[model samples]
Target: MARASPACWPAPACCNADFNEARLERYLVLAHAAGITPVVVLTKADQADPAPYVAAAQGLSQGMAVVALNAKSGDVAALAPWCRAGQTVVLLGSSGVGKSTLANSLSGGTLATGAVREDDAKGRHTTTARYLLPLPQGGWLIDTPGVRELQLTDVADGIDVLFADLIDLAADCRFRDCKHSVEPGCAVQAAIKAGRVDARRLDSWRKLTSEEVTNSQAMVAAKTRAAGKFTKKSAAKRRPN
Candidate 1:
């Protein structure tokens, strides 16, 4: 049930688009929905201030852990707790985000590195495959390639968990099925009007939820068509000449 997702958003017509931040938010929501603790690592902190990104990541979901590091030389002891005995950690990020560099640092492996383009800050795929390594502390590290396209299906649970505040606000809406778009007595819209909620956060929730429904429907339709084709083929095979 996979579909091709757009590489860039907002302005797909633009020559270069950076959708990493938005994708990161979606991933955080998915992680929370899946009951996995998310640790957001902002690499290349030495090159520039990671404060803004760290702040935004924290704002995505309550109690999400975020760390900024130079990956190449930063102290990784902060990540030690997640590497405790019998614990398995997975690193997910876009290409050139320093996942490999951090993985090498933590696991003591010389994973190759690549330089990001100066113009766009995009990097080549240095780590083409996934690797499992033993950490110095007593756990396992699974490093994967940076994802380019991620689609969500039936992800309302994840969105609900991440946007609990919004859900609570929606509970006070005038109607149980309020769409929050031009609807009367919409508490979510009221929160936006009162500056209590970021308009962008509400938009993200709507986008994810709508996309999930669309993806789910598409998947179901595809499966139904496939089953129909299979039935037709089976009937033909059973028909005697």
Candidate 2:
């Protein structure tokens, strides 16, 4: 079943990469949970090898479509097969990754792409600012901000989707609650036993999950503190009356 997701995280909030992978991945995962399937576009094709990146993304996203081409004058029509009526696709990427270039191409080569600095090839952000571009054919694409750090708060299943292999292996642990640490009959351990699942993948999943849980707790605490302060301010204001 499609998981329940909140709308606070709009599609436009995706990170291209010039920012941080963890952040971009989080936003993308949220979008996925929220029922928005993203087309992973590997920008800066001239500079970066889109193959390895797309390969990793496909492995993480599981059946999600990823297309890599020069957005400078490239057409997204090749990616059209994946789109259907009333779908929302967001373009996320780093600054020099040519997000605008691809957006312009998708927009029929009319969007004035914000140019990046030559010294570092960094674009002036706030250029997109959550603008929704309509595809002449159908559907819409949301261009979002450049994300620097993506802190996980409510992403447990998203991690599983991003790391399906580890999750699938996790199910068969000797104990249902095996932490995959060093259990006697841990399925994950057996994979490590069979030399199939790399320990790095498990480590990455654990790191992301732990960090997300911690971040969620801290955010809740901060919100409580802020609410207390706000309540105090309101009480003082009412006293004058």
Candidate 3:
């Protein structure tokens, strides 16, 4: 019968980038939109060269802080200030992005993590629930179940900050409503043609925008239906005042 008020906190406190740069875009987008001001601490540093990962993330995040974390070595404190008190943060990324591993590192203990088997491409999901663990100094770490598909929930306001090039180009488009696709005066397309914008980045932006629209629609529908169903009985039991 009623719409819930908007949440004022960032969620899932941990985010894993893995090999997907686009996913990081979504995560950072969500973080920035929530006013969380994320300091990205990347895990699984020993698995591969994290320099490229850092570079890729820097490209998406501009000046957002990013640190390569090897939890086993106890280097997670590099993200201390962000995780300090007076803040609630969420970790989001695909499975095996070391969400749990980093949590264990921050909390200082052995949390379960399934190693990637020699043959199978999937990893064992060790974190079955989302829980907040208090940091030794202060603050909390909220670890979540690794999601294969991160449907954009509340990050629409962050697209511009996360994808600044596209935003800047749109400002210069001849037509105010330029769609970036074959709209004659679309500056985004012009940038793409001139090698000023990476086609892949443009495509990623399109894909994320589409997914955000779809996810927003789906969430609204689901919430509306649930509200209707849950309140029907209440209406019948209502007493005249």
Sort all candidates by TM-score, best to worst: 1, 3, 2
For 88-204, candidate 3 gives per-residue lDDT tens digits of: 446666666677777777776566877654464345677889877777766666777877766676568877677887989889898998778888888899988998777888888
Ordering by lDDT: 1, 3, 2
* lDDT of each candidate versus the true structure: 0.74, 0.63, 0.68
Give the TM-scores of the predictions, in the order they appear: 0.86, 0.76, 0.79
Q: Considering summed lDDT, which 10 consecutive residues are worst modelled in model 3?
A: 1-10
lDDT of 1 by residue, 74-96 (tens): 46777787886667677777776
Among residues 3 or more apart in sequence or in different chains, the pairs in candidate 3 whose N, CA or C atoms overlap within 3 Å are 11-90, 12-90, 12-91, 13-89, 13-90, 13-91, 14-90, 14-91, 14-92
Candidate 1 Cα errors over 4 Å, as ranges? 1-20, 238-241
lDDT of each residue in 1-241, candidate 2, tens digit only: 1233211222221123343344446766666555555656656655665666666655555566666666654445665654434555566555455666666676664555666677765666644476777766575666666654566787766776777878888888879889999778898989987998767667777888888789889999999999999999999999965
| TM-score for candidate 1, residues paired by index | 0.86
Q: Alpha carbon lDDT of residue 116, candidate 1? A: 78
**Candidate topping lDDT:** 1
